[model samples]
Target: MSSTALIFHIQRFSIHDGPGIRTTVFFKGCSLSCFWCHNPEGRHAYSEIQFVASNCIGCGECVYVCEHHAHQLKDGERFYSRALCVNCGKCAQNCFSGTLELIGKRMTVKQVMDEILRDSAFYESSNGGITLSGGEPCLKSVFIRTLLEQCKQQNIHTALETCGNYKWDKLNSLLPFTDLVMMDIKLMNPDKHKQVTGDSNKRIITNARQLVLTDKPIIFRTPIVPTVNDTIEEFSEIVDFIEELIELRLKRGKASTNDANIQLELLPFHQLASDKYKHLGQDYKAAQLIPPASEKMHELAEIAKKHAIDVKVR
Candidate 1:
């Protein structure tokens, strides 16, 4: 019997995920349908096909390989008949320029840990560790917990970047082995959260509160999207929520009265996902949504500073 994990990517030498040089494992599947998702292809739990027309030399190799006649050129435009395609991957196999590609891979836990431990020297030197990110890591709690446990066995520091949408018990079970927990608070208002993410924020908010009560090192990340959650009122609500959590910890004797440190990071929006969406054969609806200007990002950093939360715009 072998333990396997369905992972989309294994990014090495990642400095932004946590402290030092770390390896980030991007798991597939997510519960929320955020409009601004960078890895839209990773949102699905299975492998997906991606086509890049520019890379095609019009060799018609894919047309010959696809048994279902899914590949066709009409009016000199390459069109994919997704309905008829069986995802046999024969077309991608026949592509020379890699105009067509597949996005997900299945690996056993031992295979993943082997790759992660290769950087053990780097982790020891920089205080870096393994960061499991996702579509929503909590959704794959069993795999995540097993992976984290293995990291612990190897004396590797472990971190999780989550959306905080899982049940409290499920999340709490992994905390003992996890060194740091990074979570996002997308929207405080329920209706606005639903309108933007197509899901309610109640579960996410509740899980965040429960996680913070454990008094573990937690970093709250908020994506600064324009005309959505980049308002002063939303920032204020976030601050208030943190303040409430601090109060709860005090009442429970979990924190000292003077220790008010809360790590928070504000991530500005970017158009990096547009090309990726195109590669995945998905529509890039938010391609025009530009990132905030440097000056505006600085202003928001100042606003977050006023709340006494250490804020970094990455």
Candidate 2:
């Protein structure tokens, strides 16, 4: 098993990811290409350089330092060629304007634990712990398992933020160390799911069914995208699935979601990551999609509440 993985960021004191304040380890790489993904940098499985044109000062320092001619100044404007860039990071290192950035870093379990131990006290006090989030943390399952093993040894609560597209065995092994599981159920129709996320929902739904049998806490999340799955009928299909899962757990003599062990969280889409897409030289195809108003979220939450499970709009 590999001990190191490509990590992009470690966000400390994160309140929204899990039960309490958490230290979220953001890994690089994903299986899905959700149109409204906030972390476009995490999409690639390898390290990448991000350039923000608006942040450029036209200092030509990057042009002066680039070895591959990736950075060029033509018509008094700086241009970056992703095809020519080799990710040596020399130009990013030399650029003084913070315009260029290397997004991913290779981290060992030991190195990551050093950072997690920093907030041990907060974890103990707030019921918060370590949450592994990513492009898809399971993409580096072996590495995540090692890191999560370290977390469990420390008696810290462990959680996962996954897309549920991996094979059942891949995720099953990590559940022993995970105290909570947060998986996305973006779309119900397999074809529609493939249309938006670039993958069929077959494996995801299979995982969800298997996950329901386990006693581990689970949170099913559906991001509310405007033109994608905003309708009551569409959203209700997801809620109906959750209700069925709760029934499945009850049949197995496990705690149902009604007892708070399982729940649904609705996340509204936002353009906060618009600039992130720009930085990554990728277009935000969902740019024109408007955010659902607060009242709309409340309405959806109410629609979800019609089921036996607890529903909350985040």
Candidate 3:
């Protein structure tokens, strides 16, 4: 069989992913189970259906097409039973209002490149290119490397958004073709990190140390979720760690004052993706948590700025 990847979405004209307007290719299958993950649909590797209850008009359109009896109308209301569904995409195919939809699609590098090339003009104009994000792109290492190689051949700028929890061998192979690396550092405390994200921070920290040794410019991100790395002291500790990496790069002569290749971005957590859990039949863990205030995010940004590194809040 040929190389195939389960891609969930292709977000076009994205700004926050990297510099300028870009197209973000979201891959499926994540190793971590972050409780506050905004993109829960990407956690699984297989193709699944996402149900948007609000969009369902109870028109019984899906009921007629689903051979597995995954969809039914009860008292003029649509009732979806995921247990019987085999994910053949028959019901989702008939969903016009996007009430029942498929999340992941199997595609090859050439197929995905067709979509990326469509926005080449926008990328060149905005100094933006293709960004591989999502359910941890590194989990699909070989396939990602192939796709990145194709992008390099086409002279398309490439970036990888990763969780940095995988084995180094997997990520090291893709680094050559990647232009920029965006990695998340949600929590510093190992115990707390495992509790929230369902994985230890040991591999993450080790991988980060290795990333600093390379010449690749990296942006280590921390999503400021309330009750989780949102305090000033904890944030400061993370900044201190980043400062250490910067110092290492400088000591090794890989960077100077002008070309400091390290940056810290503080991302504020929100409950906007609560519906994503409802769609995927999972609990919204960040449901009870509130987003930090704008002033607080700025305060944290200022704290990080005290160190000799770049700090951004969003």
Global CA lDDT of candidate 2, please?
0.90
Clashing pairs in 1: none
17-115 in candidate 2: lDDT tens per residue? 998889999999999999889889889998899887878989898899888999899998678999999887888888888889888999888899999
The candidates, ranked best first by TM-score, are 2, 3, 1
Worst 10 residues of 1 by lDDT: 253-262
CA-only RMSD, every prediction = 2.0, 1.5, 1.5
Residue by residue across 73-168, what tens digits does model 3's lDDT show?
A: 987766888899888888888889988888899998889999999999998899999999989999989898989998889888999999999898
Colliding residue pairs in candidate 3: none
What lDDT would each prediction earn against the true structure?
0.82, 0.90, 0.88
- Alpha carbon lDDT at 75, candidate 3: 78
> After best superposition, candidate 1 residue 138: deviation in angstroms?
1.6
Candidate 2: which pairs clash? none
Model 1 TM-score is 0.93
Q: Model 3: what TM-score? A: 0.96
Better of 1 and 3 by lDDT: 3
